[model samples]
Target: MATTEEIEDLIARSALGDRAAFSRLYDRTSAKLFGIILRVLKDRASAEDALQDAFMKVWRHASRYSANGASPMTWMITIARNTAIDHLRRRKETVDADDAADRLVSSTPTPEQSAVAAGEARRITACLDELEQDRGAAVRGAYLEGRSYADLAESFGVPLNTMRTWLRRSLQRLQECMAR
Candidate 1:
Protein backbone atom coordinates (compact mmCIF):
# COMPACT_ATOMS: atom_id res chain seq x y z
CA MET A 1 0.00 0.00 0.00
CA ALA A 2 1.41 3.33 -1.06
CA THR A 3 1.31 6.31 1.34
CA THR A 4 -0.69 9.38 0.37
CA GLU A 5 2.48 11.27 -0.67
CA GLU A 6 3.65 8.31 -2.74
CA ILE A 7 0.24 8.10 -4.48
CA GLU A 8 0.41 11.82 -5.18
CA ASP A 9 3.90 11.37 -6.66
CA LEU A 10 2.52 8.61 -8.93
CA ILE A 11 -0.31 10.84 -10.09
CA ALA A 12 2.18 13.65 -10.88
CA ARG A 13 4.36 11.17 -12.79
CA SER A 14 1.30 9.82 -14.60
CA ALA A 15 0.40 13.42 -15.53
CA LEU A 16 3.71 13.64 -17.31
CA GLY A 17 2.79 10.55 -19.42
CA ASP A 18 4.70 8.04 -17.33
CA ARG A 19 2.88 4.76 -18.08
CA ALA A 20 4.79 2.84 -15.37
CA ALA A 21 3.68 5.33 -12.67
CA PHE A 22 0.11 5.22 -13.91
CA SER A 23 0.12 1.41 -13.84
CA ARG A 24 1.60 1.47 -10.34
CA LEU A 25 -1.04 3.96 -9.22
CA TYR A 26 -3.73 1.71 -10.66
CA ASP A 27 -2.34 -1.27 -8.78
CA ARG A 28 -2.24 0.66 -5.48
CA THR A 29 -5.73 2.21 -5.73
CA SER A 30 -7.92 0.03 -7.96
CA ALA A 31 -9.03 -2.32 -5.17
CA LYS A 32 -10.38 0.47 -2.93
CA LEU A 33 -12.02 2.22 -5.88
CA PHE A 34 -13.53 -1.03 -7.09
CA GLY A 35 -14.84 -1.72 -3.60
CA ILE A 36 -16.54 1.68 -3.49
CA ILE A 37 -18.04 1.19 -6.92
CA LEU A 38 -19.27 -2.29 -6.02
CA ARG A 39 -20.92 -0.90 -2.91
CA VAL A 40 -22.72 1.72 -4.98
CA LEU A 41 -23.74 -0.41 -7.97
CA LYS A 42 -24.41 -3.69 -6.06
CA ASP A 43 -23.83 -5.68 -9.25
CA ARG A 44 -20.35 -7.03 -10.00
CA ALA A 45 -20.65 -6.55 -13.77
CA SER A 46 -21.88 -2.96 -13.38
CA ALA A 47 -19.21 -2.24 -10.78
CA GLU A 48 -16.54 -3.41 -13.17
CA ASP A 49 -17.90 -1.09 -15.84
CA ALA A 50 -17.91 1.85 -13.44
CA LEU A 51 -14.42 0.99 -12.38
CA GLN A 52 -13.27 1.15 -15.97
CA ASP A 53 -15.01 4.46 -16.53
CA ALA A 54 -13.55 5.88 -13.33
CA PHE A 55 -10.01 4.99 -14.36
CA MET A 56 -10.55 6.49 -17.78
CA LYS A 57 -11.51 9.74 -16.10
CA VAL A 58 -8.49 9.54 -13.81
CA TRP A 59 -6.15 9.10 -16.76
CA ARG A 60 -7.71 11.96 -18.65
CA HIS A 61 -7.83 14.41 -15.71
CA ALA A 62 -4.59 13.50 -13.94
CA SER A 63 -2.97 16.73 -15.13
CA ARG A 64 -5.53 18.80 -13.22
CA TYR A 65 -5.02 17.06 -9.81
CA SER A 66 -2.18 19.30 -8.54
CA ALA A 67 -4.46 22.36 -8.09
CA ASN A 68 -7.29 20.39 -6.37
CA GLY A 69 -5.49 20.44 -2.94
CA ALA A 70 -6.87 16.97 -2.03
CA SER A 71 -4.88 13.81 -1.37
CA PRO A 72 -4.37 11.65 -4.47
CA MET A 73 -6.36 8.71 -3.06
CA THR A 74 -9.21 11.05 -2.09
CA TRP A 75 -9.21 12.47 -5.59
CA MET A 76 -9.35 9.03 -7.17
CA ILE A 77 -12.01 7.88 -4.71
CA THR A 78 -14.15 10.92 -5.52
CA ILE A 79 -13.87 10.15 -9.20
CA ALA A 80 -14.78 6.51 -8.63
CA ARG A 81 -17.74 7.40 -6.40
CA ASN A 82 -19.14 9.95 -8.84
CA THR A 83 -18.63 7.60 -11.78
CA ALA A 84 -20.40 4.78 -9.98
CA ILE A 85 -23.34 7.06 -9.16
CA ASP A 86 -23.55 8.18 -12.77
CA HIS A 87 -23.37 4.57 -13.90
CA LEU A 88 -26.21 3.70 -11.54
CA ARG A 89 -28.27 6.62 -12.86
CA ARG A 90 -27.68 5.58 -16.47
CA ARG A 91 -28.58 1.97 -15.62
CA LYS A 92 -31.84 3.13 -14.09
CA GLU A 93 -32.74 4.99 -17.27
CA THR A 94 -32.31 2.05 -19.66
CA VAL A 95 -33.30 -1.50 -18.79
CA ASP A 96 -31.37 -4.34 -20.35
CA ALA A 97 -33.51 -6.69 -22.46
CA ASP A 98 -32.04 -9.74 -20.73
CA ASP A 99 -32.88 -8.26 -17.34
CA ALA A 100 -36.40 -7.42 -18.51
CA ALA A 101 -36.82 -11.00 -19.75
CA ASP A 102 -35.61 -12.37 -16.43
CA ARG A 103 -38.06 -10.11 -14.61
CA LEU A 104 -41.07 -11.15 -16.71
CA VAL A 105 -43.82 -12.69 -14.57
CA SER A 106 -45.38 -15.93 -15.72
CA SER A 107 -48.71 -15.42 -17.48
CA THR A 108 -50.06 -18.77 -16.21
CA PRO A 109 -52.61 -18.44 -13.42
CA THR A 110 -51.65 -19.25 -9.83
CA PRO A 111 -53.28 -22.25 -8.16
CA GLU A 112 -55.72 -20.08 -6.21
CA GLN A 113 -56.64 -18.13 -9.35
CA SER A 114 -57.17 -21.34 -11.26
CA ALA A 115 -59.35 -22.73 -8.49
CA VAL A 116 -61.55 -19.60 -8.48
CA ALA A 117 -61.85 -19.74 -12.26
CA ALA A 118 -62.88 -23.39 -12.15
CA GLY A 119 -65.58 -22.57 -9.58
CA GLU A 120 -66.96 -19.80 -11.82
CA ALA A 121 -66.99 -22.16 -14.81
CA ARG A 122 -68.91 -24.72 -12.78
CA ARG A 123 -71.44 -22.08 -11.70
CA ILE A 124 -71.97 -20.88 -15.28
CA THR A 125 -72.38 -24.50 -16.43
CA ALA A 126 -75.03 -25.07 -13.77
CA CYS A 127 -76.89 -21.93 -14.79
CA LEU A 128 -76.85 -23.02 -18.44
CA ASP A 129 -78.22 -26.40 -17.47
CA GLU A 130 -81.21 -24.71 -15.80
CA LEU A 131 -82.20 -23.19 -19.15
CA GLU A 132 -84.34 -25.06 -21.77
CA GLN A 133 -81.93 -27.28 -23.78
CA ASP A 134 -82.19 -25.27 -27.03
CA ARG A 135 -81.90 -21.96 -25.18
CA GLY A 136 -78.79 -23.17 -23.33
CA ALA A 137 -77.17 -24.21 -26.62
CA ALA A 138 -78.06 -20.88 -28.17
CA VAL A 139 -76.51 -19.02 -25.25
CA ARG A 140 -73.30 -21.01 -25.58
CA GLY A 141 -73.19 -20.45 -29.33
CA ALA A 142 -73.77 -16.72 -29.10
CA TYR A 143 -71.45 -16.01 -26.11
CA LEU A 144 -68.84 -18.78 -26.00
CA GLU A 145 -68.53 -19.46 -29.71
CA GLY A 146 -68.68 -15.71 -30.59
CA ARG A 147 -71.29 -16.33 -33.29
CA SER A 148 -73.24 -13.30 -34.50
CA TYR A 149 -76.97 -13.06 -33.66
CA ALA A 150 -77.93 -13.60 -37.31
CA ASP A 151 -75.71 -16.71 -37.53
CA LEU A 152 -77.16 -18.16 -34.30
CA ALA A 153 -80.71 -17.46 -35.57
CA GLU A 154 -79.93 -19.29 -38.85
CA SER A 155 -78.35 -22.27 -36.98
CA PHE A 156 -81.28 -22.50 -34.48
CA GLY A 157 -84.03 -21.95 -37.20
CA VAL A 158 -85.29 -18.84 -35.37
CA PRO A 159 -85.79 -15.24 -36.45
CA LEU A 160 -82.85 -12.87 -35.70
CA ASN A 161 -84.97 -10.89 -33.21
CA THR A 162 -86.03 -14.11 -31.45
CA MET A 163 -82.36 -15.20 -30.95
CA ARG A 164 -81.58 -11.76 -29.52
CA THR A 165 -84.53 -12.10 -27.11
CA TRP A 166 -83.38 -15.55 -25.99
CA LEU A 167 -79.80 -14.31 -25.29
CA ARG A 168 -80.98 -11.22 -23.37
CA ARG A 169 -83.41 -13.26 -21.21
CA SER A 170 -80.90 -16.08 -20.68
CA LEU A 171 -78.26 -13.55 -19.50
CA GLN A 172 -80.69 -12.02 -17.01
CA ARG A 173 -81.44 -15.52 -15.65
CA LEU A 174 -77.67 -16.37 -15.48
CA GLN A 175 -76.91 -13.09 -13.69
CA GLU A 176 -79.64 -13.87 -11.14
CA CYS A 177 -78.27 -17.41 -10.66
CA MET A 178 -74.72 -16.04 -10.23
CA ALA A 179 -75.93 -13.52 -7.63
CA ARG A 180 -77.41 -16.38 -5.63
Candidate 2:
Protein backbone atom coordinates (compact mmCIF):
# COMPACT_ATOMS: atom_id res chain seq x y z
CA MET A 1 0.00 0.00 0.00
CA ALA A 2 1.24 3.45 -0.83
CA THR A 3 1.69 5.84 2.06
CA THR A 4 -0.29 9.07 1.98
CA GLU A 5 2.81 10.97 0.95
CA GLU A 6 3.59 8.60 -1.89
CA ILE A 7 0.00 8.72 -3.09
CA GLU A 8 -0.05 12.52 -3.02
CA ASP A 9 3.22 12.64 -4.97
CA LEU A 10 1.72 10.30 -7.56
CA ILE A 11 -1.41 12.42 -7.78
CA ALA A 12 0.63 15.58 -8.25
CA ARG A 13 2.62 13.90 -11.02
CA SER A 14 -0.56 12.62 -12.63
CA ALA A 15 -2.01 16.12 -12.51
CA LEU A 16 0.79 17.19 -14.86
CA GLY A 17 -0.60 14.89 -17.58
CA ASP A 18 1.24 11.77 -16.57
CA ARG A 19 -0.96 9.01 -17.97
CA ALA A 20 1.09 6.15 -16.56
CA ALA A 21 0.88 7.58 -13.08
CA PHE A 22 -2.83 8.20 -13.44
CA SER A 23 -3.35 4.60 -14.53
CA ARG A 24 -1.44 3.41 -11.49
CA LEU A 25 -3.59 5.63 -9.26
CA TYR A 26 -6.75 4.32 -10.87
CA ASP A 27 -5.62 0.73 -10.46
CA ARG A 28 -5.01 1.24 -6.77
CA THR A 29 -8.31 3.00 -6.11
CA SER A 30 -11.05 2.03 -8.58
CA ALA A 31 -12.67 -0.62 -6.42
CA LYS A 32 -12.86 1.72 -3.45
CA LEU A 33 -14.09 4.50 -5.68
CA PHE A 34 -16.72 2.32 -7.31
CA GLY A 35 -17.91 1.11 -3.94
CA ILE A 36 -18.32 4.68 -2.73
CA ILE A 37 -20.34 5.65 -5.79
CA LEU A 38 -22.48 2.53 -5.67
CA ARG A 39 -23.60 3.23 -2.14
CA VAL A 40 -24.65 6.76 -2.99
CA LEU A 41 -26.42 6.06 -6.28
CA LYS A 42 -27.76 2.63 -5.34
CA ASP A 43 -28.06 1.70 -9.00
CA ARG A 44 -25.30 -0.07 -10.83
CA ALA A 45 -25.77 1.88 -14.06
CA SER A 46 -25.96 5.24 -12.28
CA ALA A 47 -23.04 4.38 -10.03
CA GLU A 48 -20.89 3.41 -13.01
CA ASP A 49 -21.80 6.65 -14.75
CA ALA A 50 -20.90 8.63 -11.64
CA LEU A 51 -17.61 6.76 -11.30
CA GLN A 52 -16.66 7.76 -14.84
CA ASP A 53 -17.52 11.37 -14.14
CA ALA A 54 -15.56 11.35 -10.88
CA PHE A 55 -12.46 9.95 -12.53
CA MET A 56 -12.69 12.56 -15.22
CA LYS A 57 -12.84 15.25 -12.55
CA VAL A 58 -9.83 13.75 -10.85
CA TRP A 59 -8.00 13.82 -14.13
CA ARG A 60 -8.92 17.39 -14.85
CA HIS A 61 -8.73 18.89 -11.37
CA ALA A 62 -5.89 16.85 -9.99
CA SER A 63 -3.84 19.96 -9.48
CA ARG A 64 -6.47 21.40 -7.18
CA TYR A 65 -6.15 18.45 -4.80
CA SER A 66 -3.79 19.23 -1.95
CA ALA A 67 -1.84 16.76 0.17
CA ASN A 68 -2.07 18.73 3.41
CA GLY A 69 -5.84 19.00 3.18
CA ALA A 70 -6.80 15.36 2.61
CA SER A 71 -5.25 11.99 1.85
CA PRO A 72 -5.22 10.84 -1.76
CA MET A 73 -8.03 8.32 -1.20
CA THR A 74 -10.02 10.95 0.62
CA TRP A 75 -9.47 13.43 -2.19
CA MET A 76 -10.48 10.90 -4.82
CA ILE A 77 -13.52 9.95 -2.76
CA THR A 78 -14.49 13.59 -2.36
CA ILE A 79 -14.45 13.92 -6.11
CA ALA A 80 -16.51 10.76 -6.55
CA ARG A 81 -18.91 11.72 -3.77
CA ASN A 82 -19.45 15.25 -5.01
CA THR A 83 -20.04 14.06 -8.55
CA ALA A 84 -22.66 11.56 -7.42
CA ILE A 85 -24.42 14.08 -5.21
CA ASP A 86 -24.44 16.62 -8.03
CA HIS A 87 -26.17 14.17 -10.30
CA LEU A 88 -28.86 13.50 -7.73
CA ARG A 89 -29.34 17.20 -7.17
CA ARG A 90 -29.58 18.00 -10.87
CA ARG A 91 -32.08 15.21 -11.35
CA LYS A 92 -34.25 16.78 -8.61
CA GLU A 93 -33.75 13.70 -6.55
CA THR A 94 -33.14 13.79 -2.80
CA VAL A 95 -30.43 16.31 -1.95
CA ASP A 96 -29.44 15.66 1.63
CA ALA A 97 -25.73 16.21 2.17
CA ASP A 98 -25.85 14.81 5.69
CA ASP A 99 -27.56 11.69 4.42
CA ALA A 100 -24.91 11.34 1.79
CA ALA A 101 -22.24 11.74 4.43
CA ASP A 102 -23.83 9.06 6.56
CA ARG A 103 -24.00 6.79 3.58
CA LEU A 104 -20.31 7.35 2.89
CA VAL A 105 -19.51 6.15 6.36
CA SER A 106 -21.78 3.11 6.19
CA SER A 107 -21.49 2.27 2.51
CA THR A 108 -18.54 -0.08 2.54
CA PRO A 109 -20.18 -3.26 3.67
CA THR A 110 -17.66 -5.76 5.00
CA PRO A 111 -17.87 -9.49 4.24
CA GLU A 112 -19.97 -9.96 7.36
CA GLN A 113 -22.15 -7.04 6.34
CA SER A 114 -22.46 -8.50 2.87
CA ALA A 115 -23.68 -11.72 4.42
CA VAL A 116 -26.24 -9.80 6.42
CA ALA A 117 -27.46 -7.97 3.35
CA ALA A 118 -27.64 -11.26 1.52
CA GLY A 119 -29.56 -12.78 4.38
CA GLU A 120 -31.98 -9.88 4.38
CA ALA A 121 -32.34 -10.19 0.65
CA ARG A 122 -33.01 -13.86 1.12
CA ARG A 123 -35.61 -13.29 3.78
CA ILE A 124 -37.26 -10.64 1.69
CA THR A 125 -37.07 -12.99 -1.27
CA ALA A 126 -38.66 -15.65 0.84
CA CYS A 127 -41.41 -13.31 1.91
CA LEU A 128 -42.03 -12.39 -1.66
CA ASP A 129 -41.71 -16.04 -2.47
CA GLU A 130 -44.75 -16.71 -0.32
CA LEU A 131 -46.90 -14.27 -2.26
CA GLU A 132 -48.83 -15.25 -5.37
CA GLN A 133 -46.33 -15.33 -8.21
CA ASP A 134 -47.84 -12.44 -10.11
CA ARG A 135 -48.11 -10.24 -7.03
CA GLY A 136 -44.52 -10.98 -6.07
CA ALA A 137 -43.35 -10.14 -9.55
CA ALA A 138 -45.33 -6.93 -9.50
CA VAL A 139 -43.76 -5.90 -6.18
CA ARG A 140 -40.27 -6.61 -7.45
CA GLY A 141 -40.95 -4.64 -10.61
CA ALA A 142 -42.12 -1.59 -8.72
CA TYR A 143 -39.69 -1.49 -5.78
CA LEU A 144 -36.46 -3.11 -6.88
CA GLU A 145 -36.52 -1.82 -10.42
CA GLY A 146 -37.77 1.66 -9.39
CA ARG A 147 -40.76 1.46 -11.67
CA SER A 148 -43.83 3.52 -10.90
CA TYR A 149 -47.14 1.90 -10.11
CA ALA A 150 -48.64 3.07 -13.38
CA ASP A 151 -45.67 1.75 -15.29
CA LEU A 152 -45.93 -1.56 -13.50
CA ALA A 153 -49.64 -1.74 -14.30
CA GLU A 154 -48.99 -1.03 -17.96
CA SER A 155 -46.17 -3.58 -18.06
CA PHE A 156 -48.32 -6.22 -16.36
CA GLY A 157 -51.27 -5.50 -18.63
CA VAL A 158 -53.46 -4.91 -15.62
CA PRO A 159 -55.90 -2.22 -14.56
CA LEU A 160 -54.47 0.63 -12.49
CA ASN A 161 -56.76 -0.26 -9.59
CA THR A 162 -55.58 -3.84 -9.63
CA MET A 163 -51.99 -2.71 -9.65
CA ARG A 164 -52.69 -0.44 -6.70
CA THR A 165 -54.22 -3.30 -4.77
CA TRP A 166 -51.28 -5.54 -5.56
CA LEU A 167 -48.79 -2.93 -4.45
CA ARG A 168 -50.69 -2.08 -1.29
CA ARG A 169 -51.04 -5.68 -0.21
CA SER A 170 -47.47 -6.50 -1.13
CA LEU A 171 -46.12 -3.59 0.89
CA GLN A 172 -48.29 -4.45 3.87
CA ARG A 173 -47.10 -8.05 3.76
CA LEU A 174 -43.47 -7.09 3.43
CA GLN A 175 -43.72 -4.73 6.36
CA GLU A 176 -45.32 -7.44 8.44
CA CYS A 177 -42.71 -10.02 7.58
CA MET A 178 -39.81 -7.67 8.07
CA ALA A 179 -41.10 -6.54 11.40
CA ARG A 180 -40.76 -10.05 12.80
Candidate 3:
Protein backbone atom coordinates (compact mmCIF):
# COMPACT_ATOMS: atom_id res chain seq x y z
CA MET A 1 0.00 0.00 0.00
CA ALA A 2 1.74 3.13 -1.19
CA THR A 3 1.12 6.44 0.58
CA THR A 4 -0.62 9.23 -1.35
CA GLU A 5 2.63 11.19 -1.68
CA GLU A 6 4.41 8.09 -3.01
CA ILE A 7 1.62 7.48 -5.54
CA GLU A 8 1.80 11.12 -6.65
CA ASP A 9 5.56 10.84 -7.02
CA LEU A 10 5.17 7.69 -9.06
CA ILE A 11 2.66 9.37 -11.37
CA ALA A 12 4.99 12.34 -11.77
CA ARG A 13 7.82 10.02 -12.69
CA SER A 14 5.58 8.10 -15.09
CA ALA A 15 4.68 11.42 -16.70
CA LEU A 16 8.40 11.94 -17.28
CA GLY A 17 8.51 8.58 -19.19
CA ASP A 18 10.04 6.57 -16.37
CA ARG A 19 9.16 2.96 -17.12
CA ALA A 20 10.24 1.80 -13.65
CA ALA A 21 8.00 4.29 -11.91
CA PHE A 22 5.13 3.38 -14.21
CA SER A 23 5.68 -0.27 -13.43
CA ARG A 24 5.60 0.51 -9.71
CA LEU A 25 2.43 2.56 -10.13
CA TYR A 26 0.80 -0.32 -12.02
CA ASP A 27 1.83 -2.82 -9.38
CA ARG A 28 0.48 -0.61 -6.65
CA THR A 29 -2.86 0.22 -8.26
CA SER A 30 -3.84 -2.42 -10.82
CA ALA A 31 -5.69 -4.58 -8.31
CA LYS A 32 -7.91 -1.74 -7.14
CA LEU A 33 -8.53 -0.62 -10.71
CA PHE A 34 -9.33 -4.18 -11.75
CA GLY A 35 -11.79 -4.46 -8.91
CA ILE A 36 -13.55 -1.25 -10.00
CA ILE A 37 -13.76 -2.52 -13.57
CA LEU A 38 -15.05 -5.91 -12.43
CA ARG A 39 -17.77 -4.26 -10.40
CA VAL A 40 -19.03 -2.42 -13.46
CA LEU A 41 -18.47 -5.14 -16.11
CA LYS A 42 -19.77 -8.10 -14.06
CA ASP A 43 -17.62 -10.53 -16.06
CA ARG A 44 -14.08 -11.64 -15.46
CA ALA A 45 -12.94 -11.53 -19.08
CA SER A 46 -14.46 -8.14 -19.87
CA ALA A 47 -13.26 -6.70 -16.57
CA GLU A 48 -9.75 -7.91 -17.34
CA ASP A 49 -9.89 -6.37 -20.81
CA ALA A 50 -11.13 -3.06 -19.40
CA LEU A 51 -8.36 -3.13 -16.81
CA GLN A 52 -5.75 -3.34 -19.54
CA ASP A 53 -7.43 -0.52 -21.45
CA ALA A 54 -7.56 1.67 -18.37
CA PHE A 55 -3.87 1.15 -17.66
CA MET A 56 -2.95 1.88 -21.25
CA LYS A 57 -4.91 5.12 -21.04
CA VAL A 58 -3.21 5.99 -17.77
CA TRP A 59 0.18 5.36 -19.30
CA ARG A 60 -0.61 7.49 -22.31
CA HIS A 61 -2.20 10.32 -20.34
CA ALA A 62 -0.03 10.36 -17.26
CA SER A 63 0.98 13.92 -18.06
CA ARG A 64 -2.64 14.94 -17.94
CA TYR A 65 -3.18 13.83 -14.38
CA SER A 66 -4.05 16.90 -12.32
CA ALA A 67 -3.04 16.73 -8.71
CA ASN A 68 -5.32 19.52 -7.51
CA GLY A 69 -5.89 17.86 -4.15
CA ALA A 70 -7.53 14.87 -5.86
CA SER A 71 -6.45 11.40 -4.83
CA PRO A 72 -4.41 9.41 -7.38
CA MET A 73 -6.41 6.24 -6.70
CA THR A 74 -9.68 8.08 -7.38
CA TRP A 75 -8.40 9.24 -10.76
CA MET A 76 -7.40 5.68 -11.65
CA ILE A 77 -10.72 4.35 -10.38
CA THR A 78 -12.58 6.81 -12.57
CA ILE A 79 -10.60 5.73 -15.61
CA ALA A 80 -11.24 2.03 -14.90
CA ARG A 81 -14.94 2.57 -14.35
CA ASN A 82 -15.36 4.62 -17.54
CA THR A 83 -13.43 2.03 -19.56
CA ALA A 84 -15.72 -0.75 -18.28
CA ILE A 85 -18.78 1.25 -19.26
CA ASP A 86 -17.37 1.83 -22.73
CA HIS A 87 -16.70 -1.89 -23.13
CA LEU A 88 -20.24 -2.71 -22.03
CA ARG A 89 -21.65 -0.26 -24.57
CA ARG A 90 -19.50 -1.64 -27.35
CA ARG A 91 -20.59 -5.17 -26.50
CA LYS A 92 -24.20 -4.09 -26.77
CA GLU A 93 -23.54 -2.36 -30.08
CA THR A 94 -21.87 -5.50 -31.44
CA VAL A 95 -24.94 -7.55 -30.56
CA ASP A 96 -27.17 -5.08 -32.36
CA ALA A 97 -24.84 -5.04 -35.35
CA ASP A 98 -24.96 -8.84 -35.44
CA ASP A 99 -28.76 -8.73 -35.52
CA ALA A 100 -28.71 -6.17 -38.33
CA ALA A 101 -26.21 -8.32 -40.26
CA ASP A 102 -28.43 -11.37 -39.84
CA ARG A 103 -31.37 -9.47 -41.30
CA LEU A 104 -29.26 -8.29 -44.23
CA VAL A 105 -27.95 -11.79 -45.02
CA SER A 106 -31.10 -13.80 -44.47
CA SER A 107 -31.40 -16.99 -46.57
CA THR A 108 -35.10 -16.70 -47.23
CA PRO A 109 -36.59 -13.77 -49.16
CA THR A 110 -40.00 -12.85 -50.53
CA PRO A 111 -40.38 -12.16 -54.25
CA GLU A 112 -40.10 -8.38 -53.72
CA GLN A 113 -37.21 -8.86 -51.32
CA SER A 114 -35.51 -11.14 -53.85
CA ALA A 115 -35.90 -8.49 -56.54
CA VAL A 116 -34.34 -5.85 -54.28
CA ALA A 117 -31.55 -8.25 -53.34
CA ALA A 118 -30.85 -9.04 -56.96
CA GLY A 119 -30.64 -5.35 -57.82
CA GLU A 120 -28.31 -4.71 -54.88
CA ALA A 121 -26.15 -7.67 -55.83
CA ARG A 122 -25.90 -6.41 -59.39
CA ARG A 123 -24.88 -2.95 -58.14
CA ILE A 124 -22.32 -4.47 -55.81
CA THR A 125 -20.90 -6.59 -58.62
CA ALA A 126 -20.71 -3.58 -60.88
CA CYS A 127 -18.88 -1.58 -58.21
CA LEU A 128 -16.52 -4.46 -57.57
CA ASP A 129 -15.88 -4.86 -61.27
CA GLU A 130 -15.05 -1.17 -61.48
CA LEU A 131 -12.25 -1.73 -58.95
CA GLU A 132 -8.88 -1.79 -60.79
CA GLN A 133 -6.38 -4.63 -60.35
CA ASP A 134 -7.26 -7.52 -57.99
CA ARG A 135 -8.93 -5.31 -55.43
CA GLY A 136 -12.32 -6.85 -56.11
CA ALA A 137 -11.08 -10.36 -55.47
CA ALA A 138 -9.36 -9.23 -52.28
CA VAL A 139 -12.58 -7.65 -51.03
CA ARG A 140 -14.53 -10.82 -51.78
CA GLY A 141 -11.94 -12.96 -50.02
CA ALA A 142 -12.03 -10.68 -46.98
CA TYR A 143 -15.85 -10.51 -46.55
CA LEU A 144 -16.93 -13.85 -47.98
CA GLU A 145 -14.18 -16.14 -46.65
CA GLY A 146 -13.81 -14.41 -43.26
CA ARG A 147 -10.10 -13.99 -43.90
CA SER A 148 -7.94 -11.73 -41.74
CA TYR A 149 -5.96 -8.71 -42.90
CA ALA A 150 -2.69 -10.51 -42.17
CA ASP A 151 -3.76 -13.46 -44.32
CA LEU A 152 -4.75 -11.16 -47.16
CA ALA A 153 -1.49 -9.24 -46.88
CA GLU A 154 0.54 -12.45 -47.10
CA SER A 155 -1.51 -13.77 -50.01
CA PHE A 156 -1.12 -10.51 -51.91
CA GLY A 157 2.58 -10.06 -51.04
CA VAL A 158 1.98 -6.73 -49.29
CA PRO A 159 2.77 -5.54 -45.82
CA LEU A 160 0.01 -5.87 -43.21
CA ASN A 161 -0.44 -2.09 -42.86
CA THR A 162 -0.50 -1.70 -46.63
CA MET A 163 -3.19 -4.33 -46.92
CA ARG A 164 -5.22 -2.55 -44.27
CA THR A 165 -4.92 0.76 -46.13
CA TRP A 166 -5.83 -0.91 -49.41
CA LEU A 167 -8.92 -2.44 -47.85
CA ARG A 168 -9.93 0.87 -46.28
CA ARG A 169 -9.55 2.84 -49.49
CA SER A 170 -11.23 0.09 -51.50
CA LEU A 171 -14.20 0.07 -49.17
CA GLN A 172 -14.49 3.85 -49.36
CA ARG A 173 -14.55 3.71 -53.15
CA LEU A 174 -17.09 0.93 -53.06
CA GLN A 175 -19.28 2.97 -50.75
CA GLU A 176 -19.04 5.98 -53.07
CA CYS A 177 -19.97 3.83 -56.05
CA MET A 178 -22.89 2.18 -54.25
CA ALA A 179 -24.31 5.55 -53.27
CA ARG A 180 -24.63 6.53 -56.91
Model 1 TM-score? 0.51
Please tell me which predicted candidate would have the highest lDDT against the true structure.
1
- All predictions: root-mean-square deviation over Cα? 25.3, 9.7, 19.7
Residue 158 displacement in candidate 2 (angstroms)? 35
Predictions in order: lDDT: 0.75, 0.72, 0.73
From the highest lDDT down, the ranking of the candidates is: 1, 3, 2
Give, for candidate 2, the lowest lDDT window spanning 10 residues: 97-106
Candidate 2 residue lDDT tens string, 29-139: 888888877666687898888788888878877776752244467768777776776665555556553322223332444667555555565588878877889889888
* Candidate 3 positional error at 52, Å: 0.7
Clashes of each: 0, 0, 0
Compute each candidate's TM-score over C-alphas: 0.51, 0.49, 0.50
Report how far residue 101 has shifted in candidate 1, in Å.
35
- Estimate candidate 1's alpha-carbon lDDT, on a 0 to 1 scale: 0.75
1-180: candidate 1 lDDT, tens digit per residue: 889889999889888999999899899999999987877678899889889888877877788787564456767877887677667656666533232111223345666765665566569988889999988898876543335687789998999999899889998998788656
Instruction: List runs of model 3 lying over 4 Å from the truth.
Output: 67-69, 94-180
Tens digits of lDDT, candidate 3, 64-169:
6753223577566666766776676677555222211112122344567655644665598889988976788789866544356877899999999999999989
Question: How does candidate 3 score on lDDT?
Answer: 0.73
